[model samples]
Target: MKLWLGTGLVEEDVAGVSPLDRGFTLGDGLFETLRVKGGRVLRLDAHLARLAAGARVLGLPLPAFDFAGALRATAQANTLAEGVLRLTLTRGTGPRGVLPPAHPAPTLVITAAPLAPPAPPARLSVAEGTRRNDRSPLARVKSLNYLDNILARQEAAGRGTDDAVLLNTRDRVAETSIANLFAVLGGELVTPPVSDGVLPGVMRAAVLAEGARERSITPAELATASEIFLTSALGLRSVRSLRGRELPGFSVAEHLRTRIDGA
Candidate 1:
């Protein structure tokens, strides 16, 4: 595979970073996973806009580059007409200690690879001893610090499930380990508000733009949902079951999938 590191495209085996890179040392960075179809990135503007927002919140300088152009170039370099593109940005090498350098140079890395075929409907379980803090600024940003998600996902895997649902500190359903959650209740499409410590996913935003409502969703509410699904840049995936109980049919989720595919 080929990747774009800093200014040029290079073989994946040749890509390297300094030992003191803040991103590697302290998870001090941001990233975006973009979907590429027919050589064009889906929601390019939205991804960049979100990255810009994250940079502003973290006080990290945006690296000077043509993001869209670089993405296209990297995809072309890899001969990827349909795949995933991961763009990562980090505060370049810094000295020992937590204080960021006065003059920080940022590192930008873009990698593209073919996407695997979509998987079957996901079986989900609520995480056992973990909760998202809705009030934390870190909850709103897609920083590299994903140990919480990693461990939660591992817990689900140990239980022989595809994913785990995370709740907020107040026990309101926040989202799944990797995707935004949605439910159809009383014939209305609803999802947990971002204020509930959910990542504002690009695909989630698209679904809302198509008329999904944002509301606080409790575990009981999820239990009573007529249908459930998860959204990510990859697309909408139906939830087959939650905590060992079968969910309703996937009609609503399938309809939304059609709408998104057509969009």
Candidate 2:
């Protein structure tokens, strides 16, 4: 696979690393997956903003890098129609002991690959794997430590499900294995509050604000919804059937999604 290592393009193996890299040894890193479409990587600013936020939380230095240049460089490196782009930042290599090194430069990698649009009306199984409460200081940060999500997704796949819905320690709906969660009830717009341990997805943030401003988010307005959806860069948004349970579709939400696209 071709990848962008900093500002240059290189074959995946060209930039070799030590087995003692902290990311492999202790999961000391973070990652962001973005979608590229129509010659533009949608929501690129939001992705970079979130990456900066995660790096801040982890005390990693930005170190004077132009990642957008790197991404564009990678896109130029290979020919791809449309694809999933991934950006990974690690704390770099370190010694055997657990104590973090005094001062370590960060490692950043970007890569892309061709991919198809995700299946529509995606059906997700309620995940058995639990989402631990907002304990980790990095709860809001996107960290490289993704074993939890990996295991949950595997559990869902094993059950022949398309995706997973995770509940928090308090049994409150938290998020899907990889996306945020929302529910419409009684004409009032309601989603599991962010404080409940949900990732602040860029789309979710836009929807919450725009949906409320235009009165398109009230659940009470839709006793019989005409659509239901979940969003991420790869899927943009996918209507849901939900683990054999049919969620009432909200015409308002669907309409808003259409408007969002047009705008």
Candidate 3:
């Protein structure tokens, strides 16, 4: 695979980085996954904005590069017309301590690969005894420290489900392992607020801008939801079932998918 590593695109088996790189050692980094359609990246500005915001939150320096141009070049180099592009930014190499360098440089890596065919609709289960700290700043940013999500996904897999639903400390539905959650309750479209420890997903913002409401949703409320769906950079996907109970329909998910595609 071809990857962009600061200088330019390289055809390499492994992308190298310093052993002391904070991103590798301490998970001090941020990443953005973008969707490319017909050789063009969708929502480039929004992705960069999120990255910048995350960098500020982490006190990490932003790498000096034309991110959009680099993304396009990497996609072209890989001949990826319709696929996913992942941009990773790290707090560069540091000493053997937790204290960061006063003048640290940042590392940027971009990789593109063709997307596989869509899998079956997701079957979810509430994660076993796992909840995000709603008041933690980390909850609002996409940091490299994703062990919680990984473990939650594993718990779901152990139960033979596609994903796990994570709730916040208040027992409010936060999100799934990798995507934002939306439900059709009382014939109204609602999603858990970001304040509830849900990551402010790009697609989630679009859905809300396009008229989805934000509300506190508990597991009990979710059980009564007529329809449920998940959204991420990969796109909208309907939920087939939650905790072994089948959901009714996906009309709302389909409509949002069409609206996003049209916009």
Candidate 4:
């Protein structure tokens, strides 16, 4: 029951709480898991933007946070190592009612652990995804409620794949379990637009911005691409070796691999 509530780090006794906390009882919270590297977080600003966006989605009054200071503290708490950095902000203990309290204090916790990058991905596996409706408010928020992703991950594992590429109800590619998907058709890198029911991932946004700057992605030209790839804070970038029975790799993938590897 150790927790990081507000600015001070405290154990359960000091923090003083009950077992029926709203976050524990109803998953009333939001969180972000970042991959830390080089004493910095990848695409830190983008993560903050997403966090704010998620708060808005949940109708939660976000803590007036010092974004940079938290990163510095998290880096120190975590040390310089390849690992996961997670920040969870829960609307603090509340009474038994569906209506949220007027003056709610947020409970904040940052978790960190060591990590080692995975071996170069030889292939990306595709599995069925939970068809999330466009109106589902949670889709836009990275909330503590993750039953959808949990079930999706479990099904993906049984399908004998590394990860699942979730699709929208329109059958368009949404994203992966924990990453964003990009495809190259006609030598132009293409990814599903954010409006097409996918989280605007920080790393994904960074790569797209970079590619656009380099004139690598041409708008609305990805449907004719030669290959498809995925990226995340941890994965960074990996090309899909095969899609179903079709071999989707291209010479461009090799080139992109070189470019991303060099980064």
* The candidate that achieves the highest TM-score relative to the unseen native structure: 1
Off by over 4 Å in 2: 212-227, 250-253, 261-263
The candidate 4 region of ten consecutive residues with least summed lDDT is 212-221
lDDT of 2 at 205: 69
lDDT of 4 by residue, 39-90 (tens): 6676667778888898887778887878557655766654645666777888
What's each prediction's TM-score? 0.98, 0.85, 0.97, 0.80
lDDT of 2 by residue, 128-236 (tens): 7657365566667788887778888898899877778776666666667787655555555555666666676777766777654222222232223344456565643
Query: Which model is ahead, 2 or 3, in terms of TM-score?
Result: 3
RMSD of each: 1.0, 3.8, 1.2, 4.5
Model 3, span 217-254: residue lDDT tens: 99999999999999998889899999999998988888
Candidate topping lDDT? 1
The TM-score of predicted model 4 comes to: 0.80
C-alpha RMSD of candidate 1 = 1.0
| Model 1 residue pairs with clashes | none
Candidate 2 at 58: error in angstroms?
1.3
List the candidate 1 regions with Cα displacement exceeding 4 Å: none
Candidate 4, residue 100: the lDDT equals: 77
* Candidate 1 Cα deviation (angstroms), residue 36: 0.6
Name the better of 1 and 4 by TM-score.
Answer: 1
Query: What is candidate 1's lDDT per residue for 120-148, written digit by digit as tens?
Result: 99999999768888999888889999888
